[model samples]
Target: MTEVKKQKPGNSVLGLFKEIFNWYPSSYPAAERKLLFKLDLSILIFACLCFFVKFLDQTNISNAYVSGLKEDFALNGNELNYFNVCYYVAYVIFQVPGMLLMSRPQLSRWLLPTLEVLWGICTFAQSRVTNVHQLYALRFLVGMLEAPVFAGTHFILGSWYSGPELFKRAGTWFICNPLGSMISGYLQSAAYTNLSGVGGMEGWRWLFIIDGIFTLPVALLGFIVFPGVPDSPKPFYFTSDDIALARARLARAKIRKPGPLNLDVFKRSLARWHIWIFVLCYICMIIGGYPTSYMNLWLKAEGFSVVQINQLPTVTYAINILASWLGTTLATIYPSWTIYTGATGGMVFSGICMIVWNIPKALKFVAWYVFGVSGCLSPILYSTVNTVVKGDSEERALIMGSMMTFGYSFNIWVPLLLFPTAGPNGAPRWRIGWPVAMTFHILLWAGFITSLLLHRRE
Candidate 1:
């Protein structure tokens, strides 16, 4: 898995263009070159910033629990895990339409930003929750608000960018996620140690309030900068030939097996070679990756004081950012093989961290740092959808849309539903992490191998 590999390709640009013609039906407009590039750059910047803030608000809960909420609510026996579950349930329910609508890339300019504001408010509302029920309601709504985020962003990026370009854009988005996580982790740590003085609010509540305030402005900015396909917008640079190409692209999109919530698409997605492989792979990567969300509580349970607990999550996330950058950079420079090596090493490192649960508490932290290497893979994979599947713009959009929706469903469910449970015994029971973490790696490596083989066969 660590080995770098190469893809078979025609040597010349013309051969590459011809290969694209065999599978790509989406035509381009002969727009003014300068305007086309300008609009795309503007949108990409806007979208990346929006994603960055959105993540900051979303991961606030993890911080809240570690800082104060768990003690105030006296949460016990997987309550935090339940918190993960609640949001995920709502997240799973709403992802499909968000993705499918991208079939008309035109819809995303409005759709993406609108959802941002709605979810931003939900994150703000979470600050006011006085009990578990209220937390549940607010978190659930936040999930619904956030449903379109990853899936929506995936479509938007793909609509404007080509296959090779997908990794960087997807990496751009994933980088936002960890950056969000890092920010949230640090904020959570800080709230616990210092910021509990805003109108008698607990540190957790203040965390939500602060996060909301941060997100609202960015959401507004999204409208001004969000990018989509060249034909989808007004005042775009397009020649008559380019317009014809764009039309052909849309026509091709229609035939790639798209429809409204149909069983066929669902079944096909489930049977997709990528699906089970990813599930097994991610289940472990995520399981190993669990520390990102749970690190605060773990720090406390492991004998760190509140101030120390603060440093734990923030530091671990810093390591993850480094890992994410390394992984993405590798893929960017060596598009053919960096990912598989990163994926295996990352998952296995995460497992080893957990497996050696008793060796020294410090090693778990190191393990998390290593796990960060693969932390960005899922989102990067979403960006790579175009490479794996061939369709006209419309059909390709549908496939990406559907896949992203389902992909988020996995994101929503796995953390909350599949995460192991323990007791209200007031101690972190991660001792059982050995088999659990090992199981995760076995499945994930299987996924990497499977995806590699499938990509090779294709």
Candidate 2:
């Protein structure tokens, strides 16, 4: 039997620096190193860009709404929330089925990019919406088309990279979200200033139109650039030897090119404790991480102008990118359940700040800044789940889809239920929102500890 190697406790500070710069060297052969570089360039780049576009489109709606879409469409009384709900409804409905279908042999290559193009079109269509109902329908259509891509990309990442290599790649991929957030802020601000009424449209509408125009070419390139499922015929960039090395690495790790989806796959996956535990944990993640949404709305209510509203929340995205990198890097260096503890710390800080709203306005701003740091949790949590469920490709795919679906399922109602459209003194005051976020963060931390115990006991 092969012996399982244990990780060494390298100096934490030094290790963190290495992870920060991606300077730690592995002992792979020259051939494997070449293959890894090639994969990182060809696969990871496009995947990250696709993720950037995905998030840009999703969050731009909020930017557009606050900038102008709300007034133009006569939206009122939580219709903004309803627009988000519509997206989640379609997203949740299509997620698992889409992943299952995309998992079939030879389908992902064309299918995934095709869906990206379609969604890009749907996003552009949002520029044409005339009413709340029209906005809802288009967002729903975009959701359905966008559903499978994120989870599907996670599955593909697992296929190409082993556990240690995967998290950083996942971090690189997931950082696109913050990058997108930052870009959305800049884009909306620019559009509002430069593009407003340029050609007979509101600046917010131009945000959708211009962003959609940028998305089409990337989706087209994705068709040519995305590496297909691991076990498929090698791409033109990969020689036969590189293909052999790729499969051998995965095989040595016992990562299979999962066979056809079947009843047994579902049965085995769903019956596992990790699946349910991780799913519930992710649901809490979605709920606990809800405070960031109010950043812009609060600023708006506080009488920030259109540009200020779009530009200020970007501070959170900046903090988010830094926090995400630190969290994922620490996880890569240490490889422990303790990685999640960082997220819990940020949440606790945010909760305390919110709970004590009577503090000076400067402290309230600090609380909001720290609130952005919690963005790290989702990527780190995803990495942890991928590390635990590495053995089965089908199960990994299903679990990822299930986790996202379940999280989003609750998101369909949780925000409206927990967050008021308007809060006191132009602040979300969150009376209930902050406390609920705190409770979920506590629960999520406990779940991590519980999962750690269960894993160790096993």
Candidate 3:
């Protein structure tokens, strides 16, 4: 007869607290806690900073658009939309290749930092663009460099943390997106006030310059301190025993060290339900989530000052962080419930808000709020993908890359095709786009249900 292990009662207050935070699993030894503290301090800190800066760099373009880039470069008539799409096209093209290279053990140490530095340089060069073509070229380069970092970092986090630990950690890491936006808004406000006309650069140009200059030092630090995966030599903070424990824990969890890219892994991953279902879920999530750039665009058209436009979006980001924290915390406790609740609930609320947006100015702001908050689905979706493919390193990498690749691939054209920026005579504000996005959100909800059913069946 098979032995049935008894489940522990998680009723103790201390136990409940730890479980809620995903801190210090009760089974951990004192030494394990010490090691984890070190890992969290060194690895998580750098990873979060890298992601924070990357997003800040990415979103600064939107800020620049409002500040002065559009006027300075003579941008009119779909050029801004095209510029946005160019980044994603490069992203779709380069993400998988970048991940392939980053997964190599020999290149793992240097690839991320090198890419960060290069992208930072590319971002800085944006300040100097004289025309739309120069802006497009630079955005593509920036996108290419940024392609692998998000998914690559997520994969690394998965490699280090166990299944239960992964969601909250990913939440904390992903929260940096909102945090970055908040910080960038403030930074842009400061730059526009203080740096305008300095060195003949517009405040928006100064924003790019300052953002780029800040990135290189971080790249240097990441190269020095960020721990690679367990398969590599132990980081200086980790003892040999800590390394052994790390490997053993992952081994017991069936996590595999990544191997070189090959046909067999691709064939096998394509055959798996988890990869396809979750990746499809991801594509829907991207389509259904709030449009970041549109919020600023709307505010700009509503006759808000540049600073008001910059600052208002931070409120959206604030609400986003709360929703994200709530969703991830609930997911840590109940994965299925959080998954269903976030996808279905957020979509319904956002769809209604978008549909009824014109009733009041307050309603429009509320629609944007709900849309931003709905971004909680992003990390939940990513964590689901990470957990589903945890044990196979190559498959995990391929799936992660493919998930982003296809998601961005859709982004390259779908928004352009479906969400027209203007009607005849250059009228602004795509109110029609909101309902279109809401319609897609309904489709996304269906996709989530199908994915859940598929996952449950497996």
Estimate TM-scores for all models. 0.79, 0.94, 0.92
Better of 1 and 3 by TM-score: 3
After superposition, candidate 1 runs with Cα above 4 Å error: 1-40, 192-194, 235-288, 390-421, 424-434
- By TM-score rank, best first, the candidates go 2, 3, 1
lDDT of each structure?
0.60, 0.79, 0.75
Once fitted onto the true fold, the runs of candidate 3 whose alpha carbons sit more than 4 angstroms away are: 1-18, 290-293, 424-432
Among residues 3 or more apart in sequence or in different chains, the pairs in candidate 1 whose N, CA or C atoms overlap within 3 Å are 26-249, 27-245, 29-242, 30-239, 30-242, 31-237, 253-394, 253-395, 281-444, 284-440
lDDT of each residue in 142-238, candidate 2, tens digit only: 8999899888887788787865577677777887888898899889999999999988888999888877987898888887877767765566788
Compared with the true structure, model 2 gives a TM-score of 0.94
The sequence of per-residue lDDT tens digits that candidate 3 reaches over residues 145-187 is 9999988888778778865567777777888888888888888
Q: Which number leads on TM-score?
A: 2
Count: clashes, candidate 3? 0
Number of the predicted model whose lDDT against the real structure is largest: 2
Query: RMSD for each model, in Å, please?
Result: 6.2, 2.6, 3.3
Query: Rank order by lDDT, top first?
Result: 2, 3, 1
Per candidate, the number of residue pairs that clash is: 10, 0, 0
